[model samples]
Target: MRHVVKEKSLEDEEEESLNRQRLTSARREALSLYRDILRATRFFMWPDSRGVLWRDVLRENARREFEEARFEKDPEAVTRLLIGGRDAVESALEKLAEKQRHQIQKERGDGR
Candidate 1:
């Protein structure tokens, strides 16, 4: 009886740890995706000054994408979409960061 109890306790601990890891990863991914979306929108609308107009359109499209992906009900597909979206967003942000860095360097050169 004591051995069985110990085994169950260990199993419970392992499950808890796995759940915690999953939650932490999900939170990190969510933040990354959110940041990417914001950065991408800014990059798109900045020079042309269409931020306000584009925001509404982007929001609608984003909602539809989420709903469609969720409705698919396939774990693999869900994971792929979430990861793909995050990667795409991260890529956009990286591009924006590089552009900003270049612009800063140009300004410094002109100031010299």
Candidate 2:
């Protein structure tokens, strides 16, 4: 009985340790994604004075979304959030690039 109890305790400790490691990794990835999204906001362009407003909106949106997910305890949920955020950021970047390309083409008198 004693040996079985000891083995169970060790197993529990190992499981707890693994969960802590996973949580730590998830937090690190979340923070990295948050920073990347904020940094990418700088590339957003808007005509006239609305540029500043749009940038602020983007920043606030990103912060709010991350805050909403701050209490997520499940590793799978955290991973999903990180992946979704990354995809959204990538899509925004692609749109920005496309817009810039169109502007350049327009300036060159090339209609497409």
Candidate 3:
């Protein structure tokens, strides 16, 4: 009976350790996503409708969002958030690139 109990305890410990490792990995991924967001914001040097810098606004929103999700424990939720954040950032950057390309084409057409 004692041997069985010890084996069960060992299994529990292994599971707990795995959970901790998963949490650590999730944290690393979240931090990386946050940094990517901040870096991307720097590319938007223009101001918004309120005349405030878009970079500052984006940084603030990103920080708030990360804070709000800091306590999330569910692995699935964390994965979803990370994916959604990445998609949003990629979409915004792509739109900005398209706009710039359109502007360049317009300028070249005018030049010609």
Cα deviation of 95, candidate 2, in Å: 0.6
lDDT of 2 at 17: 98
Clashes of 2: 0
Q: Write the per-residue lDDT of candidate 2 for residues 16-85, one digit (tens) a residue.
A: 9999999999999889998898889887645336546666788888989989999999888888999999
Candidate 1 lDDT, tens digit per residue, 28-93?
665566556765675555432645566556556666776665445344565687888877767766
Q: What lDDT does model 1 reach?
A: 0.66
- Model 2 C-alpha lDDT versus the unseen true structure: 0.86
Score each candidate by Cα lDDT: 0.66, 0.86, 0.93
Candidate number of the best lDDT: 3
Clashes of each: 0, 0, 0
Q: Return the candidate ranking by TM-score, descending.
A: 3, 2, 1
Candidate 2 structure, TM-score to reference: 0.85
Best by TM-score: 3
What is the full ranking by lDDT, best candidate first?
A: 3, 2, 1
